[model samples]
Target: MAEEFRLRSVAVAVYGPAALFGLAEGAMLPVVALSAIDRGATTPVAALIGALLGIGALATNIPAGILATRVGERKSMLLAAAVSAVGLVLCLVNIGTGPGALVLYGAGVLLIGAASAVYSLARQSYLTESVPLHMRARALSTLGGTMRVGLFLGPFAGAAVMQFWGQSGAYYLSLAAVLAAGVVVYRVPDLETTAEHRAAAAAITTWGMIKRKWRVYATLGVGILLLSGIRQTRQTVVPLWAAHLGLSPTASSLIYGFAGAIDALVFYPAGKVMDRHGRRWVAVPSAFVLGASFVLMPLTHGAVLLAVVAMVMGFGNGVGSGIVMTLGADVSPAVGRPTHIGVWNELADVGSGLGPLLLAGVTALAGLGFGIVVSGLVGFAAAGALWTWIPRPSRGLRPAAVRGPPP
Candidate 1:
């Protein structure tokens, strides 16, 4: 009973901040391109500007890991929250439309992305050090689920505020959310760690740790890359296809919300499956279903049909919640775990950035539908990669070095 109580407390501490942070991100993300356009950027320039978020995150992942390793998770989180607040404040700046405005907004978005990398690494590190091996997947999945729930609700909240305050309202909402998250994190006590563990983690360089785990990175890392690519590509596929089918923006948003609702509902169950059966069970099915959905996406011509496909895509995504983080935790060493997770996150982010590029190139060569179909093929490849690479758990198999003590 005491163990359960501790687990619950940890959950409240970690997941609350995550949900709030996710809400801020969700509210802010949709307005990025629009904000750019409003600030005098061309359509293409606006798209590129919006992409700075991912670029900034990719650039900072390793550094975030290093920082977390040295300063501890709580401090890292606090620093990240401060940076995110600054970013939101920048977003709120209202200069007349020009290069000056664009530069400020772009810088803000970049800062938010960089801060997110730190916050995410810290949170994942915290959970990895707090939960026992048996409950790792469930805890991580619940973490993912809470973030998804926040994301689902955030846009509506943004819209509600937008009715009164316009695009700037979203930024205000995000700013408030991030600040609240920081407060929640501040109120929680840091996880207890031995001096030896801290010294050991601090001694190992991130590169050295990667060298030691090269095989794991080469094998499972590639699988994670492909999976992330497919998942990210799904975001583009739906809206692009909806536009192709002449669906209105309102219709597209509704379909997206419907799908997101489904996506947010399945994380806990997915985690349970991973804990009970294995990671492969959820990972394989998720990739397969997502692939199948993409393959069928081009065939849909109406809102109803597209909504149905979107729901399937959502379900596919929902089932794979926390799979990446759980896999990272499973493979990370107790020593320098933050750095290992940072590398893992970098790989996934690279894949995410690449997916849309691949889609764009393919579409330029062939057609939108063909490009989407190609992405679906990539999904199948992801499934195969995960199936081949993920370790098969046996009855005698013990958790890897990253697992913490029992609560």
Candidate 2:
């Protein structure tokens, strides 16, 4: 598997466009928040703009899976890019048009979210069929790492663009990057397909796939849901906790940025470990560490302790970069790969959407401290579930025709 993990031309072609699309998305994140604020939205309303991205993705996930089955990964990505370009244009056009601007901006961003779902699901499905089983983890993990790199760099680039041209100008960066990604998708040679792949895709309706994989979806998939939810909660709760402790916004932002750096640094190595060892090596520890971070949130008093905890949480998240997607790829049937992964991704979105809501509800009923603690407990429980539920690929499960596309 290690030997087979070499980066060939086709892999490069796929990854290249994906990285560009990620760069565009990363650059757009902060801009959307600021743009909404500038459009006369209150602070909470502006925050909702950021939240809409996830909401839109959640709404589109299942449908995107169906679209992928009909049109295939390459075409789906191309369509996504085109739609995203239109969304970016709308955001740019509505730039400072008063309170009504948010409506336009939100709509555009929502459309972009749908496009992202399609692009992501299609690419994941394509990789599942294109890469060998043994090398799959590394390839998918590398894919995750590449997007992180783009995300890391995107803000800096967007900030520079905003500095000169204002926040609205940042949309142009996204627009251009998206177009470039589209070009790559258009020019690159498509991965070869098989009759089984087509038949499986065609036969597997979204609802049918859900019914067929209900057991896995309900069990191991729940672990993934909790994992994703907990991960998102950390992002929201950490900042809220910082505010509760009277940490200045600047200090908190700096701490989070540093932690994100730590997360980005570990991607390739994490992939390597997952491949050589097994999923449990990273999965269980990540769950424990993340859960502990949340539980320990109230225990941190000063800035330094908070920073340390943030770094630990980042490390936990970093190591688990592609775990959800990798596990989804490992378990999905080759015939209806996109549908299975789509449902998996949709479950993930449910977790992500529910996380902040759960924290907010918990905080209102109890205290923020208790809410954090509850989240941590969920993480610990999820860790337990993942360890017990996720099946380990057999030592004898080497690359074979049985693992490949149907003849």
Candidate 3:
């Protein structure tokens, strides 16, 4: 009963903050380009400015990890939330349209991104330490699910606020959400840490930790990168193909939302399957389904066919919600775990950035359909890589079956 209580408490602590932070992120993301344009940025420049969030997150990943290691997860989360709040406040600043305003807005977005990196790493690390190995996937998957729920709800919230206050309202919503997240995080109790764990963590630098796990990083890391790339490509392919079919923006958004709804529904089940069976069960099928969907995308000539394909893509994505974090946790040592997770996040981000670039290049050289096909091929490759690398359960080792609550 005590164990169950602890588990539930941890859920409230960890998942609550995650959902709030995700809500902030979701509410703000859609309005970024619009805000940039309002600040007098050209179309291309606005797009570039919009990308600052990801760029900042990508750059801060490792540093965030190091900070988590030093300050511990809860404190790191609180600090990140504070920084995110500052960023959101900056976004609310109205300096009028010009280079100065654009630069200020970009800086605010960048800070938010950086804070996001820290918060994400901190939460994942906290869960990793708190949950037992057997329950890790479920815990992580639920974490992912909560974030999805927040993201799905965020746009609607933003839209509602915008009705009265315009695009800037989204920034206000984000600020409130992030501040709420910080308060939740601040109230959460810290997990108990062993002297041994602390000593071990303190002994190694992030670089040394990476060196020690180079083999895992090199092999499974490649698979993770490919998985991320394919996922990002899925996002791009759906909208572009909808455009190709000459679907109205409303039709395209409906299709995308349909897929997103499916995506949001599957995380818990996926995690349950992973904990009961193994990572491969969910990982292999997810990549395979995504790859197959992308491969089949070119053949869809109408909105109905495309929506079907998009739904399949969503299922593929949904099932693998926490696969990356789960895999990273599975392989991470108690020592330097934050650093390991940071590196893992970095690789995933790189893949995300690359996937779109690859699609664009291929589209430029060949065609959109071909570019999506290539991305599909990458998915197949990811499946193969994961299959080859993800460790199989030892004989008769059904961790979930034997579990009460993980020790």
Candidate 4:
């Protein structure tokens, strides 16, 4: 356990830059939506900024998988970070009025998406190599937690720069963050690919490997789909819910940010439990906490009540969201890790993108409480599935299982 802790620490250090890049990846976009509107984009046009970013990410996923396989995950990641840095710099073009601004925004997002995909692949592959299978969950939890931390900080950083120096200042800060992250990555030691991995220069050409493992992936997809929906509801619908019950936007944002901060602090430790006790110990409790939070969130009308709900939600998110990434990394075949992880990340995003839409309908028809309860139920179901059939250490790699790496 001590040795595993040491190794996981090193892995976390390697991922430090990764966390910064991730912060920049998610932080600015939502705020950027506001910027776009200020720059004269219509509400639909402003919303399009976020939609375009998602679409761009979806488009690049396949290509990034191919690139990671051909170029090596390390190289792919470094390039991804560098390109993203450049894209962040391009945010200086705040299309204040015309379609030209929209075009530039689109281009910047496309580049950002391309870079993010490659960056994520490299980080996943790197952690896979650095951490033993037993400790991998904890390591990934730390990394994911960093990303959540970045979420906490990125908006503030962007907003601060914008407040003082304006939008140009914010973009410049974004560039600096990406560049700093890229520099750290470039300074790191090289990650070697296995011979089997080296020989494969293409994206997954044959479906056989993935098809055979369909059960695992399918189960994961369903489970995370639930998690993603929860995340979406929290992001898009929570504010409205708060308003219905009289919570301020500032208070709402704090609730959201606090959850992320708690996740950052708790994920690694929780992951250690996952490594030692078993996934169920973490997965089951995480779901219950999250589900209870959702069921109670709509009912809470005061700050004190909301704070309790947020803390519960954060702890549960740390377990489910952060832990899920680690498990996905574990299940993938080493040779196709980048591509496999890419698909997993994208599937997670499926819930992320669609979750808001589902919440919208729920809020429209049933009300905020209905949406919260349904979303929480989805999380509960996901946890239940993991508990019942996620192939405990009895079948997969855990203390009881042998030392062979996950395929």
| Best-fitting candidate, scored by lDDT | 1
Assess each prediction's global lDDT (C-alpha) against the native: 0.89, 0.82, 0.88, 0.69
State the displacement of the C-alpha of residue 80, model 4, in Å, after optimal TM-score superposition: 1.2
| Per-residue lDDT over 159-197 for candidate 3, one digit per residue giving the tens place of the 0 to 100 score | 999999989889889999999998998788776666776
Give the C-alpha lDDT of model 3: 0.88
Better of 1 and 4 by lDDT: 1
Model 1, global lDDT: 0.89
Each candidate structure's count of clashing pairs: 0, 0, 0, 1
Error of 3 at 82 (Å): 0.6
What's the lDDT for residue 208 in model 4? 49
Q: Per-residue lDDT for 92-182 in model 2, tens only?
A: 8765656678889888989899899999998887776666666677778878877777787788788888888888667888888899989
The lowest-lDDT stretch of 10 consecutive residues in candidate 1 is: 396-405
Off by over 4 Å in 2: 1-6, 95-100, 395-407
Ranked by TM-score, the better of candidates 2 and 3 is 3
Task: Estimate the TM-score of every prediction.
Answer: 0.96, 0.93, 0.95, 0.89
The TM-score leader among the candidates is 1
